[model samples]
Target chain A: MINKTVATLEESVAGIFDGATVMIGGFGTAGQPAELIDALIHQGARDLTIVNNNAGNGDIGLAALLKAGRVRKIICSFPRQSDSHVFDSLYRAGQIELELVPQGNLAVRIQAAGAGLGAIFTPTGFGTLLAEGKETRHIDGKDYVLEYPIKADFALIKAHKGDRWGNLTYRKAARNFGPIMAMAADCTIAQVNQIVSLGELDPESVVTPGIFVQRLVRIQHQPAASAA
Target chain B: MNKWNRDQIAQKVALDIPEGAYVNLGIGLPTRVANFLPPDREIILHSENGILGMGPAPLPADIDPDLINAGKEPVTLQPGGCYFHHGDSFAMMRGGHLDICVLGAFQVSRRGDLANWHTGAPDAIPAVGGAMDLAIGAKKVYVMMDFLTKTGDCKLVDTCEYPLTGIGCVDRLYTDLAIIDIHQGQLLVRELADGLTFDDLQRLTGVTLTYQPAH
Candidate 1:
């Protein structure tokens, strides 16, 4: 059995280079691989393209990463919020680039990459600016716009529990984008709260099978702090 | 004339939602409908961020950092509520599993064209999220917005000049001044705020509206 565990967060993110396209798994601060992101910020990887649900909720976690001035581009669904001052400034100054994908399209495009599909036509953005320059076809008398797979070089994810083999389960809504992002990346590093011995995680309960995971690191919990 | 306030508009939208309906409420004004839904009715609310069976907003202390709505505000889930991945949730949306979707709009054409996401303003930030999906995916789309912009321009237009979110998708238009239905390529005035006359609505709307009296 391949032992995929890494001893430290820095070791887990060791291979990430500048200009890497990284997929981050989280909705707001929940299910974010915070320690790993901090490690990357410390590692000083620059000109990176990040994919996530939102730009970053507050001035911590992924948002902190953006504020660090390391990201070159962001591809996400919702980018601006009240707490996203870091992104707001960077975006307005043209210091960063944004690929604003519709939320469902963002999900399925990642799913498509994992499933080995080339492109999928969705009716979500048919008549909007989102459909501009995309191939449109009328199927069954309904219009759909073509969207391609969104594959990433690396995926950083947080999971509630993981076994030695890397089979994972999530807590509540924390599972939002982790499973799909895990499958959509070339190398997936998971930060889990706990790691159980093999066979500890029920096969039926595993949300992300170990096959999609490449490495794992454990994250110690701290008292919940005020959100950024 | 006494026009409906924000909550009043939300209450009117809630009255049209039937029991046991699975509805997705857009952010902003449409989110207010959740507060006005009849308590006896078992309407399953959905948030596009992957939560189904969504309940009202949570108090400050009851806030769970993990649970949030499409608007990214903390929310509570109903007893049987569950969450899923964004892909599955969107499949439920694009596959037409939702009973209705109430959304806020910048403009809704008489032909039911929806243009809510962007205004084409040079300085305006574009955030289109799931509006496009919900606009076209839900079984029916009910729009809730002020009848006119803060600048006092009527939003109910003959044609949408802004970029459209969906083509011919709006089924009903609920505004502060009136509740109108789109039928047979015509705008039918169903209910009007008290102290407003048909001619008043017509002059305010800047469009032709047919009044259908209740039986």
Candidate 2:
């Protein structure tokens, strides 16, 4: 039947060991899989290395997980924001580690891992501090720095709809990192608003194919106020 | 001397954008350029978080938490706009698909090297974001910043002291006192603020300036 549906958020996040590299899909709060993150928090995995666009916002979702002392490190582009006080405080106290990569490099490196590429030469951070200690090349009078792929142990993502086969679609800007994170991880767990029949999802419109996604769990759409 | 205010500087930058150009305005002062874009021209705005043809801020009634820009602020989408994933969105920037990108900077060297992302302070939390990609990949990189810091330090200098975003990437610099172009390592003054002369602009800037006004 090729059904990959999981019963509960806890079951979906099961077997996540300590020190696992996890990719949480989101750009700010847009596509963040808050429910799955909450479940992972309750599941009590420690020393996680998270990858996302921002650190956290206003003590919820990723911030809550951080507050629970579950994360050891984070690799992201922009970690500082107005509401990023949780990360800000922890970072100042040196309780957590941070790897600040250029946003384009962060995206393409994850894409490279998913695409099965060894490395890529990008001009983004050439001759800058970020490119220091990295291999650089001059191609056709242009300088480029070598960047490697970033793979993950698991990816937690949010989607608008999913089928039993695990095919998924996302809404608006909420689709930011979900598709790529799914492909870059060994096991991609998705939380979807609705679970539809196999034939209900149009084959052509599937953003994350069933092949990339491993498990799908349906979540009720809670009001925005309760999301935090 | 009467310097150009923030909005006036943005308006000046907006005027230089050609018709039908695809532009990415960095957060902060550069975002104001969107409001002054020529109404007759069809300029496509790109947000790094995966949106193209971006419009202005949405009304409170129409705000959607799912739809936000790179700054985490709610925004609307224009007709013919589309959403994409982060990978494809960054690809658009790094692949040279974008025509212009306006950014804010802390320091810009005479050679057009950009230093905006970090102050190199040991205590500061460094966040690079897409600034480096936009600086190097856009066909034209325009920088909008104050000419001097609050402490009276010049931002346009012979050399940048802070960590660089990109090397030799900036094309034009729009500051409060003058509009300058970086041509083959030379700072060419294109226009000065009202009541400000070339000598006045030179005295304020940290580097040598050449007087080359646009005809």
| Candidate 2 chain B weakest lDDT stretch, 10 residues | B198-207
- Residue A139 of candidate 1: its Cα lDDT? 100
- Compute the DockQ of candidate 1: 0.68
TM-score of 1: 0.96
User: Candidate 2, DockQ to 2 decimals?
Assistant: 0.77
Per residue, candidate 1 scores C-alpha lDDT tens digits across B1-215 of 99999999999889889999999999888999988999889999988777899887789988886787777678888899998887888998889999999999999999999999888888766778888889999999999989999999999999998999999999998888888999879899998899998889899876799998443
Q: What lDDT tens digits, residue by residue, belong to model 2 across residues A115-185?
A: 99999999899888888899999999999899999999999999999998889999899999999999999
| Candidate whose TM-score is highest | 2
Q: Pick the candidate with the highest DockQ.
A: 2
Write down the lDDT of every candidate, Cα atoms only: 0.88, 0.92
Just chain B of model 2: what TM-score?
A: 0.98
lDDT of 1 by residue, A111-148 (tens): 99999999999998897888899999999999999999
